[model samples]
Target: MPLTLPSFHSMQHQQDFFCLSPSDSTMTENDFFKIRPYHNTKKQMPVLAKSRRGMRPMRSSTTSTASQKNRKLRYYSTLPVSKPAITMNHSFHQQGPKKDFISLLPYEVASQIVSYLDLSSLCQASTVSRSWYSISRSNEIWRHLASRWSLNIPQHIYPHQLDWYHLYKQRHILNNRWENGRVATHYLMGHIDSVYCLQFDKQKIITGSRDRTIKFWDLSTYQCVQTLYGHEGSVLCLSYNDHIMVSGSSDTTLIVWNMKTLQPIMRLRGHSAGVLDVCFDDRFIISCSKDKTIRIWDINNGRLLRTIFAHQGPVNAIQLQGNKLVSASGDALIKMWDIMTGECLHKYAGHTRGLACVRYDGTKIVSGSNDKTIKVWDAESGYCLMSCEGHTDLVRTLSFDKDRIVSASYDQSIRVWDIKTGACLLNFQSGHTSWVFDVHFDSTRIVSASQDQRVLVMDFTTGLDTQFL
Candidate 1:
């Protein structure tokens, strides 16, 4: 039998009597009767616990405190608490919203996707939203995109105009402006026309020009060593053996020059019209002429060995790779000839316009044409491997390196392109102010000649370099 506290019914009667009494300790067990009853909404209200001091005060819900006053202060100190756990019923009623589709992608990943699109598509995609706008504005992305569209941009874009046609003029330092450049000692000039062709040995530069002359320049002094004069008209084409220089003149003659003395060794004449192009490998000199025939000559004796009459129109260019001779003609055909027997091995006819020039870089024969395109052909089979088209004007001349092919056009620009992918690597336009008549590359540098009456040299030792003819 536990002793029971005063009943609430008995305490209610005392509270009415207590209202007339005002003494501090005058109230009996009915003192608490005036207080309101607890409610569920007031779960944090003060609670009383039985103790030695009769009815003790409330304590905070922590183990650190004992006094009610200290506990009350501690509760107020922690004004903010972790959120209560969500009830199962509430969680089941709601689901998280799906993220925006674009927001799910990373910025680099978006840019990579944009890169796969063409220029027109890229421009449109950039305007789709602000995030895409940011990706489009990146210089790396735009620069790469520009390169893919056209190889004419400077390798490093500047704040100024970086278009392809204007790049050469801005970059090339003329003889009058050589002092303003970094390496002034390394430069050359000689031809009245742009130096269309260049061949380098250990010590000299042998150049041919539309001015109908071949010049030997001393590399150390950058001065004309000797001028070999024999061709009656513009020396439109040139080739070299280890010891001799062969030039094809528009005057319908091919002259072989002694490399050491720069003297005309032999003036071989057979074509009725201008001999537009010439080439030589180990044993023979091959020439193409406006006379509409391809002639193979013995280099040692300067004698015509075999003549192949394959093209109906003028043979504008010739290239010899091993025993095969490839010729591009004004008839819009490329004919492959057997060098040993002078037989027509194969004929490639696809150009709607005349082919202007051809070059053999051991592995392939690259040709340019009035059709405004360059075609790479298999030297062995005469199969057309690839055709590169972009020039607005006739592509007049072509040359190749191990990894790249270069073209000169009547459009007055020289374009460097990757051989395998047909991607453009660089565009040079500064040195020529008129139609670029011809272009060629030695093992180390690129050279171009133009009707502008000036030759231009691009030195590989410097970063994107050029010098006047």
Candidate 2:
């Protein structure tokens, strides 16, 4: 059967059916071919393919292409031209001014069609013409991509702002550098004794050391801005939030300092032994000690809240997640506790020797042990997921973000591992000359403390975009 074309006696109605404007009433067969729905073609083409208005119909070079084009022209030849003055019996078509395919469609409809393109294809399409360029850089296109990574972008979520696309570009380049182990290393060296524990945010780094004091370092300058003297013994652990910073000491005392003023507010001396680890959320200060106990303290006045003779041996580390607490101990076990009810929610046992450090994100738990191995555990079922083995001595401290884990050990080495696969990503054995005591990281850098009395910073953010980080 011959292909039947819609009668164009009424051009106004026929134009709507083809998604065309009034000016296209005199369109030619070539225009009709361009307007045809490309059934087999993908919405996104190869980034290298050049086109016009980003809506140029893809041309196929297959054996069937000759027949397809012939069929399209044949179909167009039979359709009547919608001319107001021309007679219906005219034999050949009389074409008017030619119109490009993109201009012929409603802009919103055209934009929706091109939104399927990935960033690379969109960029290539922008060079085709002004209309394609406008659509390619539109805020809507970039915003959709931003939402895929996360919707919490810092600024310019509204249209007409171009930072969303810029952020997307920066993150990809930074990730590639991290996977390739490309980074710069900086050192901080003022502690009189070994650096023991550390934490940092965007502006500054806070570290506790065996020097019997806690020090604050400016992140940008990498210099010690201030040092506070309160602990009579080595400061072993620390934790802080927006309002207060707390440091625990081998003096068996914990001191709370006002974050804004950096002045000591209260000192609670109750633990009979050295405080080994400390952590807190918004409401409670939780600390574990060498006395084989975990104590919860009121964050405001240093009031003793509750105590759980937490483990069978010295508690090595503790982390707080909302109302739940997880503690690792020398008894070679990890226990999750309900903060309010004081009930043991679960227990994880796998390491052959005692645990030295642990970190969790509520779903997954990563623990380092004297057994010389790191274990990843399913937080829900207490089952071991993967055992990462590389350290030659006791794994002393560990930390993790969403993508990878950074661990330090008595072997005088630091190792980075993929959080999901347990494969070692990077190893740095020369940064410290003694046991590494603490480790932490953010999106752009890894910070570690060691018994060598020095802090090493492996920074991957140089010359890369880390605005979102």
Candidate 3:
């Protein structure tokens, strides 16, 4: 008789009966079946016996009488009586290799990879795996990211307790809030006349007015807590650091105030005409006046250290950084001066009309003028980098950071520009109903005070409808 063979369906059912060998720890029963060997009655029984050693034999409890008969007949007819029973060992089955390239990398290498991604990309990567989530939340990675954007984390925060990821998210949310124009506006009204200049830190907003008074506002309550009265004429400009403030006025004097007590600490009298602008550091107080001179004074003794004939016209604005100062004058000139020596280091003469406002970081100088144009200059070379034009009237106030410049104008508009290319990024026309007199910004928001007697706060990221008081 011809050799009997099990049907294909019967063979599949029998394959499931192969017992998993506990001794064969390398692979599993499912893995064994993935590359199962084919069997035939005509093949040598010795070769089949050798291969079967890798798997253990298992009897099927569910085999019916007819299935058992078929299995017995097929096995008895296919193998010689002298052959020993074959056992299946699952250890011979090979498993597919792991694909965890990211997890396999060293911790430093993994964090470095995450640092290259932006905030949005880094956030998405955190969801990839548990290991990846931990690596992406590393504080060093986020701190480096914050520094890249020039976003300073508050100094009051404990070093080990800083949450860089949350800090970045908060700024991102605020930026979106401004870009979408969704914000809550609080009106701070106290001055009976036009507000001229303002400075703020984390706790309070200090503003000067043509009403000859300086008001200190509680940022949380939006209420005027203290009104400083001493200046005989309209207070034109102001600067503050730590808990000390320096205010210059049309009275031709500069008063240093203890901001915590809201009282005048000392008064320095030297300017012969209206003081246009003032700034101070820890040791020196500097002021520019309509008298066409810039004076540096010793803050401790209230004595004039030196004076430079700074301009042919009134110096309207001045910014001090360390030992250097930049002044803008009505003669349409922007000059960089060494405060210690009273020597002019560089002069930028690009604006066609008198410069109304000016700011300088160590690297670049930005000036807005009565000619309705804004110019950016290279501080080191005294060369004009770019001229930004858009406002239909005089640009009155300006503020900037590493990436952008924000300007307020008499045209009743506030515009944001890309610092490098000098292209207008945003134009905020509906926020103010009259000339915007002063503006200040940080990484997230822009706040402007207007002649309309209103203060408008805008979110940087969202361009939503403007809210007003």
Candidate 4:
């Protein structure tokens, strides 16, 4: 070079005379620039010199502090980013895991689901948990299930308090017992003559016999406890509710008795001929007689209310529901009447021969005829819905529900038929040795009384023809 210049890196620990004093530490390039410049210090600067080879570099205290600060910054820069903190007050934190979907479903949806299950499956589900038990034991659920089998809880009983599962089981077992021909038979042999009509409740079996007396027998012991003697002729028919017993007699009178005391309350004498059948409710008493007339009586005062000349022949059977009454007559006609106004509303006339027995379920009129056929009629329209033909002889007594009709015939057989289709489902002949006089049924078993002086109870649970023998 033409002029000698001081080298910036060649001087060690040099300070300008006119500038502020530096700290007792190595100076950085940035720190050196921050000092005030001195113009007169050029001459004091060290002369330019050639650098020696392999010389060690000078260290500064500021380098370590700066490096420490830089290291901290670099360490922070390499760390992963953090998300926002979630508070414990969130719903997810409070509820933990989600609840079961079925348990969370609405009650209506749950009940509909439970309704689809059969009795066995529903019983099994009741043991799953408390929630399931509550749903399974609901009265609506059990009521629907009971309805499927045509089992109705009595109107006086509370469905919620009843054990539906046990009730169903008992019915099933009783039906099985009937199918297998295993029965607990009680002879009930107090009557001196044939028992013409019988009725029972939970406590007693009341029978009206040709012996001209009404006998009250204990259901459990099968022992006749009391005999009500008033009718001069044979007792032909009997009907009872919880508090009162009404009996029709060949003496041409109908007697109302106190069911508890077995004492006569009133003796209604208006029928010119023997009273064939009698039915009553809380308000009125109805009687059909061999005189071909239907009479309505005031239950309280024993006063005759109205009378209708219903048929040309004797009225053999009668049933009362609400304000209407249905009477089957030996005239081969079935008439539905308004008891209050003494008017015939509908007349069902299809049987070729006189009807022997009849039953009305408020909608359909079922009549068994001496024509050896059972006719089902529409009570409102007077149309013959179906004619069930199977009995070789006259069909005498029968009972029906929503599905099937169980009939007892003078042919000494009990037959089951589909109510809708009129197809014979099962024929039971071996059980009765003589004409089956009267038959009654619930949801499970058929109890039939026969002219053989025997009562046959048959199970309908299996509904198998092979079991009917």
Best by lDDT: 2
Candidate 3, 228: how far from true, in Å? 0.9
For residues 1-469, write the lDDT of model 2, one tens digit per residue.
1111122221121221121111132333223212221132234533433576859755543223456657766766677678344343332334475565765677877678778975545545554555665565556667677665543345655445556555654565456556666667788999989999999987888999999989999989999999999999999999887888889999999999988999999998789999999887777888899999999988767788999998999999988888888999999999999989889999999999999998988898899999999999999999999999999999999998777898899998888899889999888777788989999888778899999999888776676546565
State residue 87's C-alpha deviation in candidate 3, in Å. 32
Ranking by lDDT: 2, 3, 4, 1
Residues 415-468 of candidate 3 have per-residue lDDT tens digits of 888888988877877777789999998754667888887666553333211121
Task: For each candidate in the order shown, give its overall lDDT on alpha carbons.
Answer: 0.65, 0.78, 0.76, 0.73
Model 2 lowest lDDT segment of ten: 1-10
Q: How many angstroms is residue 281 displaced in model 2 relative to the true structure, after the best TM-score fit?
A: 2.8
lDDT preference between candidates 3 and 4, better one? 3
- C-alpha lDDT of candidate 2 relative to the true structure: 0.78
List TM-scores for all candidates, in order: 0.57, 0.74, 0.70, 0.65
Lowest summed lDDT window (length 10), candidate 4: 1-10
When summed lDDT is taken over every stretch of 10 residues in candidate 3, the lowest stretch is 2-11
Off by over 4 Å in 2: 1-111, 119-134, 155-162
Top candidate by TM-score: 2
Considering TM-score, where higher is better, how would the candidates rank from best to worst?
A: 2, 3, 4, 1
Candidate 4 per-residue lDDT over residues 244-298, each given as its tens digit? 8999999999989887777889999999999999999989999999999999999
Model 1 poorest 10 in a row by lDDT: 2-11
Clash pairs for candidate 1: 168-430, 169-430, 189-469, 194-449, 194-454, 194-455, 195-455, 212-235, 455-469
